[model samples]
Each structure stands twice: as C-alpha cells, then as structure tokens.
Target: MRALTPALAVFALAAVASCSGAPDEDIPRRICGTKISPEITRPLIGRTGAFNEYSRLDNKSAQTAPCDLLLDEKPVMSFRFAWSSDQVDPMKYADAESTDSVSNLIEPRRTRDRYKSVVGDDGAMATVACEKAGESHFTLTMKLPDATKPDTQLRGDIEKFMTAYMNATVKEFGCRSR
Candidate 1:
C-alpha cells in the first residue's frame, strides 16, 4: 500500500489541475447570433455543465429581442434588447427589479458618453442612442440568475460582458442608428 501512495497522489493532483484549468470547451464562442469571447463570458456562466443558447430575435426590426443561456438545461443568464421611443434609465430599471440576492446598481464611471449603463452583482443594463427603426434608444438588460461571484468582481465582469454583448447585438442586427 505504501508503494502506491505516490502514484495515487500524482493522479489526484493531475485530476485537480485539469479541472481547475479554463473551461473553453464548455463555453460557447458565440451567443444569440453574436460572437463572444469565452474569457469575457466565463465568470458569468461558470465552468461546468453543458451550455445552450436560445434567442428570440427573428425580427430584425422588432422592438424587443431576448436571449437565454442555460447550463445543464437550467437557465443561468438571460438577455433582453429593447428599442424604445424614449430614453430609459438603466439604474432605475435595475433598482426596481433587483432582488435581495443582487447588489444595488451602480453607474460605471468608465462608460463612454454615448452609453448609460449600470452594473450589479447579478446583472447589468445599458442604453444607447438609436434613431433607426423609429427607436430613440436601444436598451440591453442582462440577468444572471445563477451568478455566484462577489459584488466587486462580478460588477466589473458584468460591465465588460454587457458592453461587448450590446455592441455586438446592435451591429449584428443592423441597428446602428444611422
């Protein structure tokens, strides 16, 4: 038994190391018809389980579009894009809908002047001016139903992820607001 101890230890260490590495295979490179960076989205979606994406964006000119990310068949994140005739306050919207599990919405200081955005532990929201399709602005709201990260770290990641997602969605849907 003593002779096999070292071999067992090595096996255990290898297994742990492999498990701790990045979960590239589990995360999708694209979501909701938009290509995404796995590194930017991993913290929100986690590193395990089967992943799937469902999107309701058939109408490019539609006022609202929704997408969902699932882990092991359970919803992990949800995204909604809405075009409104008037500007919507992201902070107020997030605050009214926030639950006990989520932190208060905070405006990101680094956000560009073109966008109004808020970040929280469980979600993020951003709105950009848009004139196309008769919409005054485009709003993107993301909800992380299964997020487990701390407030500070999660908010940072949410900002980055939300920015990328919102930009990509606008371009892909040809709603650049010319």
Candidate 2:
C-alpha cells in the first residue's frame, strides 16, 4: 500500500548506495601472513629453473615461507616475504642502517630499501626489498648466474627483474603496488 511504499523506497535506496562502488571493505585485503601462492613465483622462474624445482622452506606450512629457486639441481636464488608488527619497518631500516655499502645507482625509487650488491671471485648477489601498506614487507635475494661478477649491465638487469617481480607480486597478492 502507499503507506508502506515510502519506507520500502528508502530502504532500497540505502541498499543500492551501500553497494554502489568497491568500498575499502569490499577491496581484497591481504593478511600480513598470507601464504605466497605458486602463481606468484611462477613468472619469476624464467629460464633459471623449471617451476617444478621450486620449494617452500617450511614445506608451505606457514603463510609466508622462504623459498628457493634451483637450476641444474643447484640452488640459484633464495627469497622470502615476511611482515611483522614487531619487526623494524623496512623503509626506516633502509634509511637508518647501511646493511650493504654497495652503491645503489640502479635502485628503484619506489622501493623501501636500496638495492644491495656483493660481487666476489665466485659470483654476484643482489637483494631487493619493499614495503606495502606500511604493513607487509618483502625481500628478494638472487644469485646472479655467471661465475664472474656481474658487470654494470648485469646489475641493471638484475634491478629491473627484481623491481618488476616485486611490483607484480604486490599487485597479485592484493597489496598496494609500488
């Protein structure tokens, strides 16, 4: 009846407004400790190793696990993503402490930590770290392929690869992308 019509209309309008857009509550939220899916690591494998060679350090029991990439059945690179309320903020840590004095000429501006490099007679190693939503932080460490230390070009490529991978992983995992 006409008396009930007005009340129904108000309720219907409120319902529609509530669901109109993807409010913050509707957006996917990643818990700080959600497990990294295989889909995330798949693209980063590249030619370094077969996807089958990947393994979680804790047997995937924990949401965030250290992982390794193996090539020719040898460990090529190892990385992990961890977020903790008690842990120092990665951005602040980078600013305060100089973990590695290696120059950060090729480091991406968006990253919270400067790219660190170590080149030795054996090979080269690089580390990239970033934070998301001021809550989730990730670090990726890679062992460069060549036996000799990587030159400038190799270093640049490593920076690019790690930056791309970090961005993609953040976006894929429902975190704020850099």
Candidate 3:
C-alpha cells in the first residue's frame, strides 16, 4: 500500500490548496473611473469574495457623486464627493451627524494646507478649496460600514487610501484652486 499512500497524500495536498481562501484577483484597481493603487485598497477589501463597484460620478458638472464597493453583493464600503460653498471640517461634520461608528477622528499631519481631513476607525473625510470647480470647496468621504481591521491599523489605512483617492479624484475632475 506504499504507492497508494503517496497518491492519497498528493490528493490531500491538492484538496487543501483548493480550499485555502486567497485574495480575490478580480478586485477593481479603480473606483468611479479614477485609478488607484491596488496595494492601498486590498487591505480594506478583504480576501476571497467577488467585488463589484456601483458608481454615479458626474465628472462634467454634477455637484455630488457617490460610489459603493460591494463584496459578494453586500455593500462593504461607500464613497461620496460633493461640492460646497464653504470649507467643511470633517471632525465637526462627524460630531454634528452624531456618527457613533466613527471614533477617534484625527486630522492627518501630512496633508497640504488647503486640504482639511480626518481619519477614524471606520471612515475618512476631507475637504479642499477648489475655486475652479462647481463650488468653492470639494469634499470627499469614505465610509467603511463593514470593516474588520483593528482600530489603529484601520485608521491608518483609511487615511492613506483617502489621501490617494482624494488626489486622484481632484486631478481627474480638474478641480483647481487657481
């Protein structure tokens, strides 16, 4: 039965490998037609699920745009971009809205002077002065309704991802302060 033992071992290994849940390769590299680095997005997307993006971004003249990332047909993350007549502080907005899920809202230290942003355990928000856009200020927000990371790490990742997303959207939409 020595030969049979080797064959069974091989079959067992194959079964285990197939069962191991690896990250989904089909996760989108872009959201709302704005390209983003996959490295920054993968952590929040989780491993092993079909991903779908639902977006309604009016790049031409809309004052507001919204996007959602769904995993296995369930909403996992939501993003919104809106134009405002005045600068919006993310912390104050969170407070006014009484968002209980958004704890630990801290402004990121690396952002430029014109950009005001805050990252929390479950979300991130930012506003930038953009005189050339439809409004005087552009606001971007990301909400993780179903995040699964530790608070500190999730906040850091959310900050990084939000920064990248905000930059990409601003450039794509041709938002200019000048």
Winning model by TM-score: 1
lDDT by residue for model 1 (27-120), tens: 7888877888888887776567777878886645756878888778878888887888888877667774445322244432335535797776
Deviation from truth (RMSD, Å), model 3: 4.8
User: Model-by-model lDDT, in order?
Assistant: 0.74, 0.40, 0.72
Displacement of residue 136 (Cα, Å) in model 1 is 2.7
Candidate 3 local lDDT, residue 99: 58
**Model 3 residue 21 distance off true place after TM-score fit, in angstroms:** 8.7
Candidate 2, 33-129: lDDT as tens digits: 2333333332223233232235454312214455545556665544555443233333323221346422222232233234343332222233333
In Å, residue 141's CA in model 3 sits off its true spot by 0.5
lDDT of 1 at 100: 32
Give candidate 3 misplaced runs (Cα > 4 Å): 1-24, 96-114
Residue 121 of model 3, lDDT score: 70
In model 2, what is the error at residue 18, expressed in angstroms?
60
Q: Extract clashing residue pairs from model 1.
A: none
Badly placed stretches (over 4 Å) of model 1 are: 1-22, 97-114
RMSD to the hidden true structure, all candidates: 4.3, 16.9, 4.8
Selected candidate, larger lDDT, 1 vs 2: 1
State candidate 1's TM-score. 0.77
lDDT of 2: 0.40
Candidate 2, run of 10 with poorest lDDT: 26-35
State TM-scores per candidate. 0.77, 0.41, 0.75
